[model samples]
Each structure stands twice: as structure tokens, then as C-alpha cells.
Target: LLVALGSGGPGAPSPSGGAGAGGKLRGSRTEQSDDQRRKVNSRERRRMHHLNQALDGLREVMPYSQGPAVRKLSKIATLLLARNYILTLSSSLQEMRRLLSDVRERHKKRGSYSLVFFGSELHGEM
Candidate 1:
């Protein structure tokens, strides 16, 4: 996990080297390429750091916490599930509202009704 976070690990190159073409002078032409590569890496790392911070914030607000009680969800998985849940909830609310409106219209037209279960097979006659 530490290695994945770019914190520290045996495979990671030491950061003690100075940021200059001197570091890659073995191949003069490759020196500029190395600098460009480092710039791209640094930009990518910063972007990922910001994204991870946002994910951490999301985890905090979500109902579950990391423990034996509940396993921690990955950032991507949490976001996907959150989107699905919100969409489902919004759809359900809209359906309920529509049903209520339909029932009100029915009551106004026919005067009364008993047990009207919307969206299901359940229906009755007063």
C-alpha cells in the first residue's frame, strides 16, 4: 500500500538526485527526453494526489467505516455504487409522486377508492 501510494519502497528510485540534465548525461539526446518524462510524471502524480484526497473525503461522508463491521470500498467502486443508488432513489421518488397524483385525479373523478397499490399487481375495488 505504501509503495502504491508513492510514499517509499525498495523498487522506487531515490529522490536524492538533482533535477538536471547532468543526471542523464550518458546520452546527450536523451537528456531532454528524461526532463520531459519527469515533468509529465510530476504532473500526473499531483493530479492523482488531488483525486485520492477527494476520494478520501467521499469515504468519510459515506455511511460505512473501515473495520470488521464493514470493509472499505475502493474509490471507483464507491463512486459507481453511489451513482447507481442515487439514480434508483430518484426514480422511486418520481414514481411515488406520479402515483399519488394519479390517485388524486382518480378520487376527484370517481369520488372514492380503497387500496390502490401502484406499480404492482395489487389492486382492489373499494
Candidate 2:
């Protein structure tokens, strides 16, 4: 026989048909459920904490101002700014490499190495 103790919610089955044992079983299940919920909540909190820490680290390495008067960047802004900064640096490196290659080619053509002025060349003067 099965008997519910309080609100007829998940009562245990017993061969001798007793409400006391069924109530204890239900209570145990409820406690286990609560404990599981607490564990999940704790894990979620830790995950968020770690994520925020990583974002803060990214902010530190970025080129944005970190003055006291300056407001902190939002998560989205920080990510976008970092991405753009990387792109700019990449472009500058590529330009430098191209300039070096041109200088090398010019050196090969002249046979005699001469002092090459890159100041005007960088500004569109050949």
C-alpha cells in the first residue's frame, strides 16, 4: 500500500502499508534535491567569477585609457577595442614587411649598398 504524508506528492510504496516510512523517504529525496541545487548554484557562481576575471585581464592588456577619471569599458566595448587594436597592429606589421622587401630589392639592383632614406618613402614618395 502507498500512503502520502502531507500533500500526496511522491509517496513511497511499502509492503506493510505505513505512512511514516513513506514520509521519511519523501523527506530524504527532498533534502537530496536541495543539496544538488546548492551544488549547481555554487558551480555557476564560480564560472561567472572566472569569466569576469578573464575579461579584466583583457582590459589590462588593451590600449585603452585606465585613468581614474576614465570610466571602465563594458564587456562588449573591451572585446571590440581589443580586436580592432590587433587588426591595426597586424596591418602595420604587413606594411613594414613590404617596405623591407622593397629595400632589399633595391639593394640587389644597385649592387653597391647605399644609404636608403625611408622617411619620404613611407609617406608615398618613391
* Highest-scoring model, lDDT: 2
After superposition, candidate 1 runs with Cα above 4 Å error: 1-28, 64-68, 106-126
lDDT tens digits, residue span 17-49, model 2: 334344555566667788999999999999999
Over 1-101, each residue of candidate 1 has an lDDT whose tens digit, in order, gives 76555446544433443333333334545577789999999999999999999887777766544557887788878798667767988999999899877
- Evaluated against the true structure, the overall lDDT of model 2 is 0.72
Give the whole-model CA lDDT for all candidates, comma-separated: 0.69, 0.72
Q: So what's the TM-score on candidate 1?
A: 0.50
TM-scores for all candidates: the values are: 0.50, 0.63
Report each candidate's C-alpha RMSD, comma-separated, in the order given. 11.7, 8.2
Pairs of colliding residues, candidate 1: none
Give the range where candidate 2 is weakest over 10 consecutive residues by summed lDDT.
1-10
TM-score of candidate 2 to 2 decimals:
0.63
